[model samples]
Target: MLFAPLSELYGRTRIYHIANVGFIAFLIGCALAPTLNALIIFRFLSGVFGSCPVTNGGGSISDMIIQQHRGAAMAGFSIGPLLGPIIGPVVGGIVAERLSWRWVFWVLVILSSLLSLVFLAFSRETYAPVLLQRKTDRLRRENINNNINNNAAALLRSKLDAGLTPRELFLRAILRPFKLLVFSPICAICNVFVGIAYGYLYIMFTSITPLFEQQYGFDGVRAGLAFLGLGVGSMLGVAYFSSASDRYIKKKAKEAGDLAADDDDGDGEEGMVRRRPSVGAIKPEYRLPPLRLGAVLLPVGLFIYGWTAQYKVHWIVPIIGTTIMGSLQLYLVDTFTIYAASALAANSVVRSLLGAVLPLAGGPMYEKLGLGWGNSLLAFIAVALIPVPWLFMRYGEFLRKRFAIENL
Candidate 1:
């Protein structure tokens, strides 16, 4: 949320540069911290800084690519974060075993520093508002010396005046995601599924260590290799579905015709039909098919993992199940990123708030219910919510029309 808003307010290039620098600093701090508390604080700060890519990646794709091409672009971005959770622990296990846990932070510092430098050297601004603002600023400056018509200057001055104060903008940014959560049924349902998937992931992460050690009798390093299944699954899912999302959207837009307007943009005119395909023709349903497939597979994977683990099935069985779960989970994350961005374009702040808070509830949910039933319970809940995407796909136009969110 902060990154997106900042990208709009300032510029994507500047915020990207600033965020990378801050990420490097926080990573170094994490490496240097003597106490666990300091390490936690630094990690949180690092997350705040690191969130730049996650938040802005969607908007960046939206800005740079036309709607027809955004799915593949988004899919490419999804690969990194989806694979991180799986890969991080595996790498950390090796580093900690060879050196100490502190080396985990040190390793991250070195890696993040290198990436930061690379980004600093190559990244460019992509947000349209920021780009336009820069153009406006440059034009105004050039026109200032001439006694020529100051139309651009007047426009810039008006824009600056019409802009919300920092406080109001900040509040709007923060609350918009939440408003989407409360009001948008599509967002609310997706949040529940996404939140559960996240919680299940962490629970699996925490529980796998013990399960592998106790039941399979593997050491930390060997046990951590099990995560490879999830990593591989996630990678494959992103490769497969990310492109699928874009294709699906394009296909739907063609079928729905050019009259389909986005709820986020209020430019649909019944008679303004164009024979050619355009970004405006795309609908939110393009984002849903992948999510629907994910929703179905997610629960089935959980049920398999839970029951198989409960019965002391072969390690490979649970691992296979987990791989499936991981793939579905990553797909959910990718879909939600696009969904939230599309559903609440101007109110991304609220989406970020939901993103942050929803996962907090997952830890406790798993703790009270052991792996099998805990996941099963989640699966059942997911099943209940499966109708959401379908509802939105069939009737979303009416809902958008009724609520007039297109105008908001």
Candidate 2:
């Protein structure tokens, strides 16, 4: 959460590169740990450093891409993170079996370091304020010895900003996400719904192995391969939402006419869309459609997966359910992310906390209720959450106005 705000002040590329380097160093520490305690500590530290991208990557996308194209860009950005787990276990099993457990960390270190270095070398500054600050500095330096008139100098200086004191800006940056969660009903409500969805995803991740192992009598490699079905579904979801979200936003903005005008100035401002009434106006509600689709799919997919697996039907049957769930989850997550880019740290923390806590209950739930009832409990939760997005879609603007959520 803290890192998300810093990215705005310092620029995304710099913060990302620094965080990546920290992640690499921590991975190395994990690889060379002297004891189990050391390894666990290092692992936790590494996750902290690794969170920078998850927290700020959306803001960076908003900085660089226009609203119309942002969905596709975000979809492309999300693929690697979402797909990594599905692919990792397949390769990890081989590495742990053929080499050693330590080599897994070493492999991640090498891959991560290479990617981080590539990004550091190639990525440009995307934060608008930082870019404008740099521009202002250069202009000040270049015109130091010029014979420009007083009016021209005053005009140039007027273009420079003097908005916030350093301390005030820092305080706002750190506290804004939390403030949004507390004050903005939309943010709070969406956080709960999406947080549960994210948590369910983690529970599914842990359950996949046991589901395949006990039910199908699969070995390690085969059990790991089961995740591929979910992976394929996630990719398909990404492909669909990548284009569909943008198209939906455009269509809705066009229909709403002036009512949906974007709050962003045409200048390069972080998290702000450029004004182009000709193309269409933009509104926060435009993000709710994909979320609605997800709300429906979540329960349907869970029920299907639970019942089919309980009946010991064909493995393909369960995979079909997983694909539906996975795709819908991706769409919903991506939509929430783009919609609330500025509050990403709070959103991410909520999701991560739910992800950790929910899985602890999954095993017991399944054990006590059996597969059918265990998953039905989750489906019930999803069903109850369906109204959340709908309410937000219908009355989000009213709530924003009522609460006075400025610049949202």
Best by lDDT: 2
Model 2 steric clash pairs: none
Candidate 1 residue-wise lDDT, 1-408, digit = tens: 567656667778788889888887888888889899998999999988998877777777777887677767877787787678778878989999999988897888888788878887888887655566677667667766543435654555575444677677656666666566666665666666566666667667766776677767889898899888788778778776777887788778777664443433446764553465565557656677877777777778788877787677888998888888888766677676666475434323444454455456545665687667877886797688677767777886666556444311
Where does candidate 1 clash, by residue pair?
173-349, 176-350, 177-349, 177-350, 177-351, 178-350
Error of 1 at 231 (Å): 1.3
The per-model lDDT (C-alpha) reads 0.71, 0.81
Residue 352, model 1, lDDT: 45
Clashes of 1: 6
Per-candidate clash tally: 6, 0
- In model 2, the Cα lDDT at residue 320 comes to 86
Give lDDT: candidate 2, residue 348: 82
* Model 2 C-alpha lDDT versus the unseen true structure: 0.81
**Candidate 1 deviation (Cα RMSD):** 5.3
